[model samples]
Target: MPIDNNYTVKRIPPSDVDLYKELRLEGLKDTPEAFGASYRDESTNARSYYYTLLENHDVFGVYRNTDTLVGIAALALSPKEKLKHKGTLWGMYIKPEARGNELAKQLVLQIIKIAKETTEEILLTVVASNVSAITLYKKLGFIEYGTEPRALKIEDRYYDEVLMRLPLT
Candidate 1:
């Protein structure tokens, strides 16, 4: 089902640092293969680190009832002049309880909408085994450009990543 009016999509402000941290750590822990960052490393960082993330990236959240933040996705525009035309869609997650409500798609769509304003292309990487995410990205017009073998390693295991891009130009 589509998300109803009760769910609001908005750019997360710096004041919501704690909420963003909580949800981010949850995603990192619950799905280690899905992210490049480790919970161990991020959990050790100061609040200022997360503040910098909010300051540097376009982090958008999906809220329920105006108070509960259930999902998050971010677009990081490259700072280098040569790469500035490209933006990366990263750090996307939705709480388990909020799954099946189409929150992930909505979050990604919001990122794409914002990315178009500044980027000629939006790029993303997903764990190759995550069929659901791959399917969703394809449906949203993201084309698979390549796959990186063993892109992420957690403990003794490795996870490959599928590289995808949506051309905005």
Candidate 2:
């Protein structure tokens, strides 16, 4: 499923919400400890669950054909007042078969266009071990601001996370 250098990128629509949710849950389930919240934890809150992700967050997806969902990204505005000028990039994932293609770069590049419309900065959180994500973010103008040591834990284990930001201005 490695896509060609050329693949269609589109803004995710409401019609794609179910698939979006399914892929989101897939990412959370695959890396529960890697994310701040899990599919299990957010499954109960109606307003907070998938509404904003479906209704608010700006999304971009890469399709294999014209209608299939191979990868997706979610970039949402930061909620804090001081951070309102910033947008957060997260929920980035690609199906296992779609990993080698540049779909993620395509998604990130498109998202930067959306981020540029709002603020001077974009922020993203990545597990310290996820080098490819961090690398791509850096190439897209993000820089590592700091590290959140053991920011999340699962069982007896803890994992570090890197916080990165790109100043759009």
The per-candidate count of clashes, in order, stands at 0, 1
TM-score for predicted model 1 compared with the true structure: 0.96
Local error of candidate 2 at residue 14 (angstroms): 1.1
Pairs that collide in candidate 2 are 120-168
Q: Write the per-residue lDDT of candidate 1 for residues 1-169, one digit (tens) a residue.
A: 1368789888988889999999999999999898989999899989989988887779999999888889998999888999999899999888999988778889898899899899899999999999999999999999999999999989999899999999999
lDDT of 1: 0.91
Query: Which parts of model 2 have CA positions greater than 4 angstroms off?
Result: 1-6, 43-52, 79-81
lDDT of 2 by residue, 75-162 (tens): 7887778878988887788877788767889888878888899877888889999888888888877899999999888778888999
Error of 2 at 60 (Å): 1.9
lDDT of each: 0.91, 0.78
